[model samples]
Target chain A: MILSDLVERFGHHPLGIGQEIGRMVTTPGLDNPPLNITEKELTRGLRYVAVEAPSGIRGRMGVLGPLVEQAEAAIVVKNADYAFGCSGCARANIQLIYMLRRKKIPTLEIEYPKTREEAKVMVKRVVDFLRGLGGTNG
Target chain B: MARIAQISCGTEWSGIQDLLEKAANMVGAELFFPEVDLESIDKAVEEVGVNAQSPNLRLMTARAKAVVDGAPAEAVLLLTCFRCAEGVITKHAIRRYLQEKTKIPLVMYSFTEKPKLGELLIRLEALVTLAEKKALLARERQEGITLGIDSGSSTTKAVVMMDNEIIGTGWTPTTTVLDSAEKVKREALEQAKLNGRDIEGIGVTGYGRFLLKEKMSVDLVQEELTVVSKGTAFLANRQRGEAMVIDIGGLDNKVMTLLNGVPDNFTMGGVCAGSSGRFLELAAARLGVDVPTLGKLALRGDPERVKMDSYCAIFGIQDLVSGLASGVSKEDVAAAACRSVARQVFETQLQEIDLRQPIIEVGGTSLVDGLVKEMGEILNADIVVPRFPQFGGAVGAALLVSGVV
Candidate 1:
């Protein structure tokens, strides 16, 4: 939400993997829901990852591909909330960052703020980065 | 006994009351705050025949009417936030209605995120001066020549007032405050064909007022806000109407409300270059255009095509560079930059005040054609840029020492 607010504040659109996937699935279009992945492959992940890995790391790239293609920039927030013994989320996080960096788009990675001061610093950093993309400060 | 009514957002009332009191005391007036509860607000809206959905606006409208009806105050002061959408939407109607009903003076002052103590004091002093019906400076029976010097950050302005008229005015780039003050003063004196000994008194204002005062013996050292308000009010009164004065300086911006030939309330921008003259200069430099030519270039561009998002000077430059790299025209980028500055002023600095027509734009930035155009479009009002806009503060200072304001 903070990332979205910052992106919107700077007059840029904030595209997320879940939102893109949701749109693809709900909207009528020639484009595939997961971009490069087949329906069969998605089923295999649902069956295999749900029972075996449970993290869905194998299908991470396919899901994130559309998000990266649509994004002008990316913000990755690594927090303990997602660190609760989920290997799939961890792997997907690293994969998403790698894919975003490969796209050469501006990216900001920071830990979730715990204290009020930390939150201020974190928000400032994000605001600065987003504003820097425009080549100015507010 | 002099009594003044203050109406403000309930949230800011506590924080600003002490400062308001101090200002009222300066002019020998007592401050009276109206009860700003929902019931009174509802009653006021009903009485004024206006429907207001926003609680803040309703409260302010109600309070203004309540003060005018209940308290026999000399004037009314309304404090509001620049970012309040509701306040901006309803302020004009409220002011007009209150004035018609009460037949008393009304002034509305808006603030950005944070309000500076010094700026607030200057505004309050102006209000108090109006409420108490006291002249800023005592007038002498015999008229003589008086010099007013405004040593600003970017420029020095001096005006020569002889027998109640501005006989001559001079301005030059400011270097050292003392040197610039002396140079401009000498230039004005030369133009007026008068000697230094002919000057009976000198009033100084602006960022370099103290420095100039230290170098030369001056009669009055007034605040920039005070003098600028006095000057704009004097000009507007000559035209015979109320006006909102916007002064965009090199580093700061000031907004003053003039009612009945007096500055009743005012506001100043924060320490950000986003809305200052420096931002326009920086944007122009980055665009490889002269500062004076930037406005013309912007005027040629499509106002709808270019949209600058960031309000920061540095970020605006980046946006311009990126736009150029992405195949955006120079004209569009320049236009977008001008729009962004205007947006910052209207949406951030002057957001809370309901803008009326015939806006008196003063200061060096007022000379920017694109900025003035964009401001008119954004505010949907007629902008009146006075001749010698940069000399407003200096002229006001002269008027101050001459006992005209």
Candidate 2:
């Protein structure tokens, strides 16, 4: 929520599974749900995730991969636990963060806050990074 | 035999030709690759308005040229390797180019060096459906009394008709698939002043089609791909030419390219609801307005006044909330929401095909003036919304089931 607010505050779009839950609902006549993107998108995602990874990994990569591809910049909050949600999509999230870093877009990774002071510091870091994105005034 | 065009550069080196031929044999289609002079690839690429260093990508324009210029081929098969990112982009360019340039049935695949039959069979079978069913697909009129029911993901719709004229339509938000179907069927029949026995036949289609099939004792059970096109054509009075149908539904969205009302090439699904009608619904609830009111508000507002960039409905809502809290008028937020959905659909779904004119926009979302207006502005073409657009799947079922007699 903090990240979404900061990005929107800075007039930038946020890319994350939480931001894209609508992808979970399958389109009419689509062959597969959750993973049912256009065939072209499916092909694009095929190269990113290891074939041997869990389907949860593939499914996560399937929807989130394209967003990662188009992401001009990204923010990662590492050491997040199950409370982070989407029922154990953490593995794919890990892979995607690595991808964003590799893409060499301006990126910032902050540890999940463990205390109130840490939470304040985390918010400052996010705000500072977002301000650096050179964006439109939303 | 159906003549199929084999368009690719690396098929010989990949050792996948046998699998392609075998799959075509399984579907009884004869495969033929269209060839142009080796030196013409550069000129063809320029003519097609796409540039790529891959000779294979350049060569794609040649095949597109031959197929569009009245080649004898009845279907097109496009292949490229999965490992090449350039191949995928060029392949899509070719697909879109072919869609605009010709009406021939086209299916594309990104293959591994050694492809298996299982990977290619279903796609080849779709080509067979188009080839063998051309006569039935070309039918422009419904012939008998029939009831069609579409048990869709978000709603159930029923259409009652007699001899090419629609008598009634029924719709309700979906709960239990079987119950919704039964309710709509009952409503349509009553409106038509008929009993179940008065209707000659019943047809079913949609996401919940199969569950309602045996219980409803349906006569024709077809998928949405064929059914929706038939409905769009019948309603739009364009059943005998090249027509395009864009159905932006509650949960997902679809774009179908058709010739004489038969779907030749199409793509459906959404990676984000920001592209689907559900986003509008969410925006409506947030704005304290109904979906219809939201559309009117969007027309009155200016998209330029709002600073919103939404790729996902969930995040789009965040932007909506922030704007609302910041004293942005509901109208601007609504316009922004509509534009966001339209842009998302264009970037994700519309980019997959080069649209044909006289585009018919159907499904529940078609009712939204705002969404349709935004889409039209982006595509720079007027869209036609047929009467009872939400009943596309049901109307299609009703139209085809008439042939069962």
Best by the TM-score measure: 2
Clashes of 2: 0
- The digit string of per-residue lDDT tens for model 2 on A26-138 reads 34566655445553444345455433344455556677887889899987777775666342554455456556655779988789889999999999888888888877752
Off by over 4 Å in 2: A1-138, B1-74, B77-85, B96-103, B108-128
Writing each residue's lDDT as its tens digit, candidate 1 over B1-405 gives 467677766435446566667766764667677765666777777665445466666777777777766766777776666544344335545665666677565565665545666566555555555555345523322147788888888889999987767788889888988888889999999999998998888889988886877889888777776578667655444324567888988887887666544554566676668888888888898888876688888888875665465789888778777887888787887788778788677644564344555688988888888889898887778888877687888877887776532
lDDT for predicted candidate 2 compared with the true structure? 0.77
In the range B1-405, model 2's lDDT, one tens digit per residue, is 788898876887788888889889986888997867787777677566545566776777687777777778888888877555445545665776787777678876667776656447656765766766676666778887999998888899999999899998899999999999989989998899988898888888887876887777889766677789899999898878788899988888878888778888876653357888889999999999999899999998877666675658888788888888888899998998898888777756664565798889999989888988998987789989888899888988898888776
What tens digits encode model 1's per-residue C-alpha lDDT throughout A22-123? 555676644554444453334333311211122244355445545566778777776745432222455445435545655677778788888899889988
Q: How close is candidate 2 to the true structure, as a TM-score?
A: 0.62
lDDT of each: 0.68, 0.77
